[model samples]
Target chain A: MDTILFLFSLFVLALFLGVELITKVPPTLHTPLMAGANAISGITIVGAILAAGADTSSTLVHALGFIAVTMATLNVVGGYLVTNRMLAMFKRKS
Target chain B: MNITIVNLAYLLAAVLFILGIKGLTRPKTAVRGNMLSATGMLIAVVVTLLDRSILTYDFIVAGLVVGGVIGAVMALKVKMTAMPQMVALLNGSGGGASLGLAAASYLQSLERADFGTGAIAVLAVFFVAVTVIIGAVTLTGSLVAFAKLQEIIPGKPLGFAGMRYLNGVLFLASLAGLAMLIANPGNTPLFWLTVAVAAVLGLTLVLPIGGADMPVVIALLNSYSGIAAAAAGFIMGNTVLIIAGSLVGTSGLILTKIMCVAMNRSLTNVLFGVMGEVG
Candidate 1:
């Protein structure tokens, strides 16, 4: 538990700093940053599905697990779509 | 019979999750992924309901209905610009649920001595307690992040030159506290203290992270919540929980790496870049 939380917190800090540093760099990297973050959110879909199988005794647990999975799927799907759309806006002329 | 049905549902759900991930890779198939994942979830719910031992199904049903209604309303109403805030809220809710479950299990164990003070039982309880604290911190800190992103709170990073050093010290302290708790089980005060400190650390650490960096933070917190849930599963000896937790942990880390590359930043730069000012 401690290991997971500590790693997660560390990741959050990494993200924070990454965003902070980007301002000093060129704007060309924004699309990539967004894409990367989108993938991170996608991980939740896997987690939700896994949680679905964790408990076999509670009806509520099963129901909640499914709900989480669905919600995460939406986030992942919508997130990627939005990222793609944003990238499209940045297309450069040949 | 119930176990068989539940396991089957889990199997179906796992397949759906895989399909959903595949669908999510491209814009054209994103909707399909959403549908597949939702279907998997539905299967899970139905199978769980087949279980005969759930004494509180009635209340659970009522709670489900209420939650469903509220969730639908939010889905229909939230603006795209506010999506990150919504994500933050959802992540916080997930963390809260994990914390609540861990606490409930701990209390249940204390009252019933269900496992009779065995070494495994003690380990289970400790894992649950630690998970609960970590989850609580994630929940509260994520909510605060949402507020900051929404401008309900300040978006600026907050700290001094030595603040990062202070955070490091606090982390070590939390680690020591956790070690002590493990050394002596049933230390409720120590458990709560560990939780309080961790929670503060989560907020302080996050507060300095700018809104521009929220996307990755959200992903990382989502991973934390998954882990907390996994630990709860450990206490209950739930196989699904462990699988799900590991999946998130791995994926979230991968995503974090991708984000670092996208920003042309190193992980160390991000972790220690808590400079006092931002434009």
Candidate 2:
């Protein structure tokens, strides 16, 4: 319970920091920001790694982990590359 | 090789993630910011790989290679105009990953026989349900959003007259399933039922939203993807996941608000009302 509470508090603190960090993004970059942030959402890849590599006999667990890792890798790699591409487009014009 | 060092690395990774998001505030630095975030993710992944609990490497390496190759191809080839749908697809996958992680973790816990009947059990089950439902919703919801944006399906509002009530029933049913799983902890079927209902609720919720409202919906789903990650972190007792996940969660919410204001769309209206129907 202490751990959950501690984590909850951390989540709340990060919430404030999240708002503080992204205050002045140009509207043109909103999509890019969304894209970049979406890539960060691929942080779930850490969880996926844990599940995929967990030493268990259950095929279901392995299958779910494999799918999670695959999907999250797509999310992470595709997301960052796309964001970079979009940002480059905006950068070239200016 | 010790746990403390691993945790310290995670802390450093979390800090990098924060700075990475901070970099997104400016156009000049946005690309660099994205790279920094990626570096942070690299750090996290490296640290996770070092953890003692993980024994098998075959599936992990294989999934990474396959996913990485396909993601690279899609990123290189997709037109800029299609970026939104692309982001939607990625966001959905992230959500799917979290939901998958939650389900797998639950099964692992069952195998370990560690889901005790104490308060810890209650909390663990709560996290599982949260991860499952939120992750499932974000998964299917983002997919529907992608379909609408990609023109694979009609972009118009897809709600029926009873759509609102159906959404309500589905939500309640998911909750009941959660309750049953909590009480009987061993009822895997009930647990799966909860997953299915939550997934259907995702489709139902996003169906009524038209293409015009997609920005808000996408932003909201992005937030949910982060939230699902954070919930998974709670289950795993991992700080880096919590911090990074909530960072995305908050950033996504900020983007959603910014989008609402920019599009001159009321957040609540687009978010709650059936889009094509004007009351």
Best by TM-score: 2
User: What is the interface root-mean-square deviation of candidate 1?
Assistant: 8.8
- Please write out the lDDT profile of model 1 over residues B162-265, one tens digit for every residue: 77777787677777777776666567688667777777777776777777776666666765766675566566554444444544454455555566666554
In terms of TM-score, how similar is model 2 to the real structure?
Answer: 0.96
What lDDT would each prediction earn against the true structure?
0.55, 0.88
Query: What does candidate 2's lDDT look like per residue over A1-94, in tens digits?
Result: 7777898899899888887887877888888889888998899999899888888999999999899899999999999999999999999898
For residues B7-92, could you state the per-residue lDDT of candidate 2 as single tens digits?
Answer: 89889888888888888878778888888998988988888888888899988998899889999999999999998999999999
Cα lDDT for residue A6, model 2? 91
Instruction: Quote the positional error of residue B264 for candidate 1 in Å.
Output: 3.2
Q: Which parts of model 2 are misplaced by more than 4 Å? A: B277-279
List pairs with backbone clashes in candidate 2. none
lDDT of 1 at A1: 51
Report per-candidate DockQ.
0.07, 0.83
Error of 2 at B8 (Å): 1.4
TM-score of each: 0.72, 0.96
